[model samples]
Target chain A: TQLLEQSPQFLSIQEGENLTVYCNSSSVFSSLQWYRQEPGEGPVLLVTVVTGGEVKKLKRLTFQFGDARKDSSLHITAAQPGDTGLYLCAGSVGTSGSRLTFGEGTQLTVNP
Target chain B: DAGITQSPRHKVTETGTPVTLRCHQTENHRYMYWYRQDPGHGLRLIHYSYGVKDTDKGEVSDGYSVSRSKTEDFLLTLESATSSQTSVYFCAIARGLAGGGETQYFGPGTRLLVL
Candidate 1:
C-alpha cells in the first residue's frame, strides 16, 4: 500500500505569516495533488503536479512536487484568514494510476 | 461543484441498524469511489466502481459494501452499523481511471453517526 505522511499536524499563525506543509512518502507516484478543505465541507482540489520538480502557483499558494516523485510540499505566502483550512496531499500510484493515496493532512489556522 | 450530490446529508442511527447512502452524479464520470474521513485519518477508500456491476473493495472495505447499477448512481451500504463506523463519508467522481493524474471531484459529503 502507498502511504503519504504529513508533517506539523496542526498550525496556527497570525495573518501575513508564511507557512509550509510537507508531505512525504517512500513510494514514488506518477502524479501528486493538493487539496484544501474547510470545516463542514468536502475537500476542494488546489493543484496537481505531474512531473518531478514541477511547481504550480495558485494566487497565494504554491505547490511543489518532489524531484523523486516521493514527496511534495505546499507553501502559503502571506497567509490570510481565508487560507485557514485543512491541507491534504494525495498521490496517484500503481500500474494503472487508478487510485490515490492521501496524507493525514495539516490543519492551518490563520488568525486576523 | 462537479454535479455530485449525496442524499441524507446527515444521519444518526443506532448500532446494528442497516444504513445505505446514495451518491448521484450528473457528470456521468465512469469512475466512482466511496471514502470515509475521520480525525487523524485523512481519507480511506471504502469501495470503488469502474463500471456498472463492476465494484471492488478498498483499503477499509470490511464493514461497507457498494453497488453501481447505473452510470450515475453509486450506493454504499453498511450491513450492521457500529459506533466505530461514525465518520464523514464522501463520494467522488473522475472522468478517467485514477493514477492517470485525472482530477477527482467530490460531493458535499454525508455525516453519519452510529450511536
Candidate 2:
C-alpha cells in the first residue's frame, strides 16, 4: 500500500498571508491531484498535475508536482477567508481506472 | 455541481442494524465511487462501479457492499452497523474519458452516526 503523508495538519493564518502545504510519499505516481473541501460538503478538485516538475495555477492557488513524482506541494498566495478548507492530495498509479490513493489532508483557516 | 445527490444526507442508526445509502447521478457518467472521510483520514475508497451491474471493492471494503443496478444509481450497504463505521460518506463520479487522470465530481456527502 502506498501512503502520502501531508505536513502541517492544521494551519491558521491572517488574510493576505501566504502558506504552502507539502505532500510526500516513497512511491511514485503517474498523476497527482489537489482537492479542496469545505465544511458539510464533499471534496472538489482543484488541479491535476501529470508530469514531473509541472506546475499549475488556479487563481490564488498554485500546485507543483515534484521532479521525482513522489511528492507535491500546494501554495496559496494572499490567502482569504474563502481559502479556508481541507486540502487533500491524491496519487494515481494506474493510467486508467479508479485506483487513486489520497493523503490525510491539510486543514487551513484563513481569518479575515 | 456534478448533478450528484445522496439520499438520507444525515442518518443515525444503532449497532447490528443494516443501513443502505443511495447515490444518484444525472450526468450518466460511467464510473461511480464510494468513499468515507474521517477526522485524520482524508477519504478512503470503499467501493466503485465501472458500469451497470459491475462493481469492485476498494481499500476499505470490509463489512460494506455496493450494487449498481443501473447507470445512474449506485447503492452502498452496511451489513451490520458498527460504531467504528460512523463517518461522512461521499459519492463521486469520474468525468473524464476512459483511462486515468480524470477529474472526479463529488456529491454533498452523507453523514452517518452509528451508536
Candidate 3:
C-alpha cells in the first residue's frame, strides 16, 4: 500500500504571508498532482507534475516534484483570504491503471 | 465544470438502510470514478468504470457497489449503510485514456450522513 503524507495538517496565516505545504511518500510515483478544495465542494486540480525535479507555477502558486519522484511541495506567495481551503497531493504509480493515491490534505486558512 | 453532476447533493438516512447515488456526465468520457472524502483521509477511491457495463472495485470498495449501464451515467449503491460510511462522495471523469496521466474533472460531490 502506498501512502502520501502531508505536513502541517492545519495552517492559519495572515494575508500577504508566504506558506509552503509538503507532500512526501516512501514509494515512487510516475506523476503527482495538486488540488484545492473549497468547503462543500469537490477538489479542483491545480497542476500536474510528471517529470522528476519538475516545477510548475500557477499565478502565486508554485509546485515542485522531487527528483526522486517520492515527494512534492506547494508554495503560495502572498497568500490571501481566497487561498483558504484544503490542499491535497495525489500521486499515480503509473501501473495501477491510473488510480491516484491521495494524501490526508493540508487545511490552510488565510486570514484577511 | 466538466459537464458532471451528482444527484442528491445532500442525503441523510438511518443505518442499515439502502442508498444510491447518481453521477451524470455530458462529456461522454471513457472513465468514471467514485471516491469518498473524510476528515483525516483526503479521498479514497470506491469504484471505477472504464466503459458501459464495465467496472472494477477500488481501494475502499467493500461496502459499495457500482453500475455503469450507459455512457453518461454511473451509479453507486450501498446495500446496508453504516455510520462509518458517512462521508462526502465525489465523482470524477477522465476524457482520454485511463492510465496516461489524463486530467480528471470532478463533480460537486454528495454529502451523505448515516445516523
Task: Give the winner by DockQ.
Answer: 2
* Superposed model 3: Cα runs more than 4 Å off: A95-97, B96-100
Q: Give the per-residue lDDT digits (tens) of candidate 3, residues A1-112.
A: 8899998899999999999999999999988889999999999989888889999999999999999999999999999999999999999886334788899999999998
Docking class of 2: medium
Q: Best candidate per TM-score, number?
A: 1
Candidate 1 lDDT score relative to the true structure? 0.90
Per-prediction TM-score, please? 0.96, 0.95, 0.95
Better of 2 and 3 by DockQ: 2
What C-alpha lDDT do the candidate models reach, one value each?
0.90, 0.92, 0.92
- Per-residue C-alpha lDDT of model 1 across residues A1-112, encoded as one tens digit per residue: 8999998899999999999999999999988889999988989988888889999999999999999999999999999999989999988874341778999999999999
Residue A98 displacement in candidate 2 (angstroms)? 2.3
- Work out how many backbone clashes candidate 2 has: 2
> Compared with the true structure, what per-residue lDDT tens digits does model 3 show for residues B44-74?
9999998999999999999999999999999
Worst 10 residues of 2 chain B by lDDT: B96-105
Query: In candidate 1 chain A, what residue range of length 10 has the lowest lDDT sum?
Result: A91-100
C-alpha RMSD of each candidate structure in angstroms:
1.9, 1.6, 1.9
Backbone clash count, each prediction separately: 3, 2, 0
| DockQ of candidate 2 (2 decimals) | 0.70
lDDT, model 2: 0.92
Measured against the true two-chain complex, the DockQ scores of the candidates, in the order shown, are 0.61, 0.70, 0.60
